[model samples]
Target: MERKKRHPQGSGPTFDQLSAFIAQLEAKGQNLDNPWLMTKILSKFTEDIQRQVLEEKVPSDDTRWNLRQQMHCLDMVLTQEEKIELQLPKRSEIKTLESSKKEYGKTKDIRNVKFCFYSDEKDHWSTHCPVFKDPKKNSQHLKNTNRCVGCGFRSHTLAECKSKGCQRCGKKHHTSTCFEAEASDFDRTKVKSDDARKKTASAGHNVVDGDEEDDPEAQESSTENSEENHTVLTAKHSATKRENQEGSNIFLLSGTLRTKHPHSDEFVQLTVLLDTGADRSFIEATLVHDLELPQQGSVLMKLCTFGNQKTTVKCMKTRLSIWDICGKQHDLNPYAYKDLTQGNVQGVLDIKDLMYINEKKIRLSSSAHGYIEPHQPRVIIGCDQLWQFIKFDEPQFTLPSGLLLIPTIIGYMVSGRKFQNGDIPELLDIHDTSLA
Candidate 1:
């Protein structure tokens, strides 16, 4: 037969009874074989005593409560110790702060604490504390009042002065001035210096001549060598001048365009001047319609002052053949005009669209001297396109004919004028019929 387990009764023992039981168990040397079993026994006995005390309404001693309090105190101490261990740094930051304070001569603690006190007293105080002086109030902050060496202004130093001017006129002047008084003074000084130098040189030369007279053959040979050298130098200078003149005659013309009309078989040839001064290119609407040009539709081009301006223009599909004086033809795309009147002439070419010059093209430079007149049949080509061709000799023009006579350095001229109207198609039809 198996033995039945005995169950313990409720409300069995008080704190005093439990203590006495533990004491008796220790005195008999009857130690618990298993620690878990002893713990379970102690728990059961405590629960039973608590239930009994609650039912009897009896007050117990504070030993059990004191033990629990001790346990809580021990748990709190352990937690505090763990937190302190975690906060401990491998290397202290306070040492770094102290080193910085020594280098900058400013304490971080003072800065932080001073701000706190200052903030509290700000409403009552009219000025900052004397100890809290601004770092920017040093002598370096105060600018020097010395005048500039060049311009005589009080805000700058002597090295920056630029006060050079004409001594007599008090006007701004350069070293290369053409004033009569300055020229006269310079010439007089130069003449006097030259006279002195010549006298000294002549005395030296007299001594040298005397020495050379003793050796007549050497003197004659040196004179002959100097003459030969002079002749060679003159010939070389003349050759260089001729080469420069030849190079000046070359010029280039680029960005020519041709377009065909949509309705007719005719085409219009055009070229852009590439001038920023002139606003837009000029083309007749009738001429565009007459030529069967391709239209890429309209685009919004920004005006100088106005915003979002729209213009109706066509894009020419085929490249134009630009012919030079040498009869060479270049292929170029055509750009339509926005306005015809602002151009001031019959047809205005655009400067922007013209880009890239071939090796064979002529070059012309921009100049103000070239004149444009309403009476003359002359076309006022803008400076932008002209600059690419020939460099101007002067800024202002003295003669109108000078512009027409100026020759291009290098470029081909168109052999003949492009066929306008319906001439080419009519001739083609005649040829076809004759062949049939």
Candidate 2:
């Protein structure tokens, strides 16, 4: 029996999650035959569990070298669909191993049987047959038309045949080369190791395999810079770290929009994050191009950078709607811009009017920063001309810990420390009797 290598242990919860997922798969009598599904499963495992499994099972050739070798060794056995599904390198990708193009190395057209072009029979090609180069047998071989397997030529190889190539396209290449095939994820980003990505995931994490950018996302725009598709703004804010950020005073409400590009019949669910500090919302140019969103007009907008430099950006006005956030479709007429901070952020809209803030909480005198948290916000709400309409619950008194708990419709709003990163804010317990 083959012994498996001992791997670094994973966290208990992560191990449990992996075990449950595997058990479910096993209950269905499934084998890990599909590489894509294996990769997809690998993505769900926590960062540590993935490292363990990859280190133990795929240590030798995780860089895809083995895949290339398998593709070539099983080239003859692979079906048309299999060839595409596997993303096997094209005849062109592994050209180094093939015989020089100038020299037609023993190329096979008819599968399974290797025929000798010189002797005009099976088992070997003209490369090394005993009677391959004989001048006398060559004439006899050509005369026997009954022994032709392809092109009705006696003892001639397909490479030397005068027959026209694939009928589908006028080109000499194979018929399959003319049409486009389903694309593989390999065509875009190459997945990286966990430790390798952790170094860069300080601000946020990629929901999918680390390669967040797609091929279409790299296209050039009319502007100098390129667009980011579904990129969540990763700009970090300064905040002191706390032991338990889950208890910080913060409320995260999310909504989904079912929309279809005007030109496309396919409707997709897009999630948007709501933030108050952002002056305007933005969307990726890919959504605009794919959905064929029309530009109503353009305006000059000033943007403040982390470095304190101000830059003027040209934004286009477009309308987007999310139907069921508060039981009604909220429509936003926002301006679209390129080079957004993050991906998933569709657009920043002026939504201060939709919110119902407690006036008493807003009037409470507080001078402390909030907690730091980690989360992805897709939409930011900016308070502009309608700032006066905002209201907050006023706290008449403070707690022993200097935290003020203000009541709101959803939950109590606590004010004390600065809020950053999705930290749960401290809430005032109504039993404290400070307000009474």
Find the candidate with the highest lDDT and give its number. 2
User: What is candidate 2's lDDT per residue for 1-436, written digit by digit as tens?
Assistant: 1101111234132323444566687689876446785556455434644555455554465555332232232222223334454587766656654644323224433434676555557766543366535433443454454423223344456566554643444544222222311233464234435454565456232111223333331333224233332222212122223423333332222233445556565655553333333434555555566667777665544444344543445556666654432234455655565544332221121123112123223321111122212333333323221132122552333433433444322123333433334655544211100000
lDDT of 2: 0.39
Off by over 4 Å in 2: 1-255, 263-267, 325-328, 339-375, 384-436
Which of the numbered candidates is closest to the native, going by highest TM-score? 2
- Residue 293, candidate 2: Cα error in Å is 1.7
Task: Identify the runs in model 1 with alpha carbons over 4 angstroms from their true place.
Answer: 1-285, 296-298, 304-319, 342-436
lDDT of 1 by residue, 323-425 (tens): 4434554433333442322211111111221221122233332211121111111111223234433425523221111112233322221111123334442
Q: For model 2, state the Cα shift of residue 345 in Å.
A: 11
Compute each candidate's TM-score over C-alphas: 0.21, 0.26
